[model samples]
Target chain A: MTDTTTLSVEELTQIVTRIFSQNGLSALQAEAVAAVIVAGERDACKSHGIYRIEGCLQTVRAGKVAPQAEPELIDDGSALLRVDAKGAFSPAAFAIGAPVLAQRAKDQGIAALAINSCTHFSALWPEVEALTGMGLAALAMCPSYSTVAPAGGTQPLLGTNPLAFGWPRPDHPPYVFDFATSVAARGEIELHRRAGKPIPEGWAIGPDGTPTTDPEDALAGAMLTFGGHKGSAISTMIELLAGAMIGDLTSPEALDYLGTTSLSPHHGELVIAFSPEKFAAGRGGDPFSRAELLFSAILGQGARLPSQRRFSARETSLRSGIRLSAAEMAMLNEFLAAA
Target chain B: MTDTTTLSVEELTQIVTRIFSQNGLSALQAEAVAAVIVAGERDACKSHGIYRIEGCLQTVRAGKVAPQAEPELIDDGSALLRVDAKGAFSPAAFAIGAPVLAQRAKDQGIAALAINSCTHFSALWPEVEALTGMGLAALAMCPSYSTVAPAGGTQPLLGTNPLAFGWPRPDHPPYVFDFATSVAARGEIELHRRAGKPIPEGWAIGPDGTPTTDPEDALAGAMLTFGGHKGSAISTMIELLAGAMIGDLTSPEALDYLGTTSLSPHHGELVIAFSPEKFAAGRGGDPFSRAELLFSAILGQGARLPSQRRFSARETSLRSGIRLSAAEMAMLNEFLAAA
Candidate 1:
């Protein structure tokens, strides 16, 4: 009855689930993938939601990612766990490991897990947010291809390496945030460039190793780390923490490794979970109360806490339904027809 | 002889030790305090070094901090340990808890120690850097009196909130970094205000609730968080992790509690240590090999790590003898003359 095909959350999830299964993913794998896609779509994430369906299917078709691969828990000892994702999508691996990681942290006070052989291209909030319900704090990061330059560097030598952290709240939503150490997201600069708008100073540099306000020049050159040298240092730490510390490939190494694959350029990730209750000690046994003080302070200042926008956005989309463009719907339907 | 005195590290330490001891601190506490002060002075840290002597002396003089106090560890049975500093200098607190934190981390794979009821007015890096030598990755953070405002907020409601991280390297010096989430150091802003200098855009807001480039107005209002909202979010996390999570006072509360004290406002801190070997699970069991890969790549890029400047500065100062200004020398000698 409507000119736009406004689909409810259930409808969107069903469609995404069916498409993945039609393309050879097992029912469980399809469901895992759909949960991530629906999360993105529900939150109005343009790049990571339905827009990524074609690329994801093509990556699976290209044999870069396995449609029905089993992510194995390679080993578990001490406070660290290692998982081999078996070339599956990271969300697929996350669905399998999130519960175990949370449980392990509850038992051990603090626990860490690193997922390898993964291809991740989604907002990391959901993964961390999941752990918060059980009162576990989580920290996750991953390396992709390098697109950012180091501070004072002439070439692009780092990725927009994402870092996410989550803390639990007893009565309300948990505090969760994920951010790239870069000055601006790559697409954000590209949007400014498209609109013929100037970018913020210190956001990027031209090929001549100078900062540029022209997003186009910056894009052709390299993005700068946020907060000058501090952000670059943090980026380098992420490369080491997510790459070398976890026994995976660093950014440059990942690019080289992926060059040989028919798969996409993205690869590998590291995830860590912490149990607040298990690590709880100093606070006369009431860490959660102190956490709420933060929420009260930020909201009192009329500023939003990190990830607050996404929660509201998701609620709206779920209530009003998700709207997909005509071209995207056609492309998704085509996948089913071909299968 | 020159008006500016050039003292060796040992001479400086002895002078600082004597001053603290004369000021009524126990001999052991004096030596511990002297080590941190000398480290800052040797590194040419203008604020944390000699400039802090008066405030330190006054806090002791006012009987706000106990000079002969002992910091005790209250065990939590888990990997986390809690140290009650009993109102000593943070360095004195560190001198006792650092070894215990490292040992607990090594024994449990990952351990955290929260130091409570301390007055920290020094650089946090040395605390984190000390853990690196033991092959444990360290993260230390604390909330001080509020001076920086949250992004989009009109008032200064958050502390500069320093967070530091240290990663161990096998060959080169450890990768260590400490950053305050604020746009600029408060002392730096105060200097600009004194000199009638203008602050940079995006650095602060005027008291009239507008973005301001005037240092005086910004100081009267609030210093902006670095990297905007991302920095503010990180600052909030530190306040929770170091303050409420550990059952200590937040910045505003610390200020309220210190309203009657002659002590310059700084209170409490949280320190954590992680054993890298305990968390190693990938890299064919050769964790160091993967860690090296990070060093190899970043060095190959020509950009320097965060601590490089401080290291070079410290070495030169140590070799050439630390030169203290006439005013500073007079202040140090006054502690002796007064005693």
Candidate 2:
């Protein structure tokens, strides 16, 4: 067993950056990837955090993902753009695309961009939060390979697709929310597998269409929709909007060729950024000020922004340092020792 | 007992319009409202269909909703607009706003609009469908009085906020989706109440914060989020984006007067329209042809659009006519008799 150690954000970032660089990623791409991974870990989202590092490295080493590839702009105009990711890491694509979309919105009041065939984006909130913090409201959606089942049926026809939205708030962190449209994420399944625990029924179904507690069975099975039919409907909508709208492969059939490796997993992303100033302009009051007044009033009975919980966790981590489970630490040490 | 009847969409629309006019709405406003209501009924969405007419009329009579008031443009530019609903019918607002946004998007590539202090707009898909039929992609979100609890909390803090999105497809109907973040709608409670049936536990809770099956108690209580914390997070995000971002009231605390009877319920809407031609310009393929090719490839394994079920219902209704339940027929007859 490996002893757990607490590392500052900078320390973790450096370690992650070194690991990615050693695993065949370019220095710039490694830095971007490291930032995302460390941010997830800092926010207590272990699923998308360092736990994903090994799999990403494996994909890079297998030549399934192109670490040196860069996204190319297919179109750019007043309020719309299309980008081809060219098999690069999604963080890099997003880093390149989000700013362009934000700038377009600033120039034209509204903007949208489509990113096609990118690798997995670790988490969505940071990108949206960054835009919202810059005083623009943003919405984003991404469709991934099929891992989640449709609402009622036992078939896996959709990914654990995630959607996020961010809005600026006065004197507070922007109200950022990010979530998957599945009952539980594949990462949770990994957690259960590590603990030798059976998952609750309804979270997943086996290949034979039976609900199973065994993580092994679930790995072969499908993740359930988040809230039955409504969640299923939303997931299906995401499949169309993020997948077909962005011109990437979607659903099980699309996954047949695209899902060969984690690195080559077919994916698409849609981003929308707009200025609230467009609506609140010349209304005789500061838009952000009025927004704060309105939000404060609505939250009158003690409510919180969507990102408050994650922000609270971040605060705790900042104050007391982050804590990782022994198993996670062991895995990290193993990775480092191998390196 | 009331006799059942099968009416054409035109017949239903006429009756609904007549009733709205009799209840003090202007002829044009009545027609617009009737179109939305009847279309929802024809598509089998009883929740936002005729079942809501009585409550809507009551709201109008109470002077909480205006019958003939016009929505004034608060701001207008090349690619953005804001409108004050001025207590008018939301459908009327949509009648004015949707087309304007779509037209601007066509001309400028994208457009956005904010509608503030409007009453509930029934059945968002139809409006999005209308936009998509015009070859524009549309997205809309609306916030209402808080009726949903936040994630990990039992207090009601959000309306059963609904979101809708649409995309223009080739040869087929526009892909449209509309859904609420709640596990069930407030109308579902009324349905169970009328039938004297108990809802499933966990669907709702009482004012005292205990889960209850009684519809009346659930109404007094709060509706549970569709997917627990995940759904709640999305709902909160919508509240912030649609309400706070648009400078409308969000939480209960912000209200000057609380309850269902308040004229200004802090409602807000955000609408976005995009033209694919803006991005796919000079791509050497017709827009519809490109969309069709991508859709066909993505849906190779019998995949379906999000609105396929509702569209099928509409087709079936067109063929055999809509079949209202005995109770629903009774309610319709009551309205007709009163008219």
Candidate 3:
């Protein structure tokens, strides 16, 4: 068995923040980014946890991200708010805009915040949960570099765009779900390739436009969207709303700008907030109570709600410390030392 | 070959309107409902077309849907608009609220319309198309009577909820996709049962919660959501936003209220509209033109857009009237004579 380490979320966050701050990131960007990474670890979402620190540093090293650039918020007194990240990392921009977006949603009953020109490497749950924490339902989506193919098409024209949503639960943690639109994430294919295992069919298509199970071949070609045409349509909508409508890089354009996916994708994001109280004002039942009933029905049927496991892990981590493999600890130490 | 009759779109609309009006519906209600049914026929969506007219009449005959309940719009001048459908057919409620929703979206950058107490029998594309026609992107979703199981559960606890999205195009038909979240529509299973054919795997589970291909068993059991857990999550979101949050019956509640799925489900609908011009304000490029590039890339890769087939069929139908089978013509004549 491998050795392991346990650390409080705050301790780990401080170390990660220090690494980014020491390297190049401004205090605002470093702290904001660290909070998301630590939240992932706290929730046991290892994919977005400490494992992502290297990618953030690499993007900074590649000079593709402006580490010290400040995010600027532009509000025209409309429900729409814009945050120009000035090519910085996304966490800072989101932090600067989320509160305002929540206020706007409350005032207008619905609002949207568009974050542009940022390097987005984190999952959207953190951002949505932030809004849900403020008693508002939220939806966030963004395009990555081109990696997935549209349904019935051969080439990779769509990104594995991620969509995340959250609804506040007065008596419990917020209901949340964040997922990539693709059948599988690129990292999963990379893992399969590293393990010399064949990927499952329907996960990807080869460059020749035929479905393939070989991880390497799949990597060379394009990933497929989940649910075939339905998933593809939603993915395309994300590109249009989060990418084109926001006047930022589309999947292909993002890829062209970066010339490679090795570093984080620099793109924009769209987050919409809805005030449930305002929406349910003149309606029948209490929205939150009604939501609980639906949730209970789902649980009573033996189906789990999305993010239940994460919330459970979070509870455990709050009581104890987050457990980490020895290798993960070593990597963190190395980053700290290097910085 | 089956003998067929052809009729102009307007002619068919008039016939359908006459049937509804003569049967029971007021002129306002009849015209709105007929328009949606005609649009389905015009788009060649047979499942939602003239075949659905019988269901609407059945719903009215059952006294489950009001034939003359004028929809009341309650607007607080906020971004959220509500139309109390007053147990009437949904088409009329949507018609009464769509223009106000469009204007609110334009004024606020984002807006939502909550349609409550409506008996929804039509598809959501028409509602979305209405807003898209006003140069806004629209999203619509609503719950139906329970007939689907959650991703990991056995019993039916969710609806075959539909999600529809529309994006405007300057020179072409607006980009649109409307689909049920279920792996397959319940009608498809019914058709398979009628044909004595088995359903495909992953479409449903037997009452025991085990996967089954037998159409009859699947129908008696529960249908699954598309894309496994991901689709289930989306379906659940629809229930929350359109059902619970909107202060109306959820899928199970609708089923309980109706006690059967033979008639249209009485529930609420949620439609959100976004002004692309408002969202893309102070951003770099024209959102519409940028979207065209993305669309071209998809088409360039031999992938077709979601509504292209429907659009093409619509073009053909508009030029040379909608062709219906002789049996279909007889059915229409019977309805008219009976009314």
Best by TM-score: 3
The window of 10 residues in a row where model 3 chain B has the poorest summed lDDT is B276-285
> Which pairs clash (backbone N, Cα, C closer than 3 Å) in model 2?
A297-B254, A298-B251, B146-B158, B147-B158
Judging by lDDT, tell me the better candidate of 1 and 3. Answer: 3
DockQ of 3: 0.83
DockQ of each: 0.55, 0.37, 0.83
lDDT of 3 by residue, B1-339 (tens): 459889999999999999999989989899999999999999999988999999999988889998999999999888889999999899999999999999999988889999999999999999899899999999999999889999899989899999999999999999999999999999999999999999999999998989999998998999999999999999999998898878888999999999998889999999999999988877768999999999998999999999899999999999999999989999999999998
Model 3: pairs clashing at backbone N, Cα or C within 3 Å: none
Writing each residue's lDDT as its tens digit, candidate 2 over A1-339 gives 256677778888888888887776777678888988888888887777898898787767777677888778765355667677787787777777777777777776777877776777577888788798878988888877778777556667787878888877767877777888888888789889999999988899999867999999998888888887677767766665566545565555347755552543656677888777765554444557755664553366455556676777787777777677788777776766766
* Model 2 chain A weakest 10-residue run by lDDT: A294-303
DockQ of 1: 0.55
Regions of model 3 farther than 4 Å from truth: A1-3, B1-3
How high is each candidate's TM-score? Answer: 0.93, 0.87, 0.98
On residues A1-339, what C-alpha lDDT tens digit does candidate 1 reach at each position? 244577899998998999999998877678888888888888876767887777778787877777778888754455566667877788878777777777777776676677777776677888888888767887788877677888878667788888888888876777888898888888898899899999988888887778899988898888988777778877887887777666677777776776732245555676767666654554565778766766787788787887777778787887898877777678778877888
TM-score attained by chain A of model 2: 0.86
- lDDT ranking from best to worst? 3, 1, 2
| Model 2, C-alpha of B248: deviation from truth (Å) | 2.4
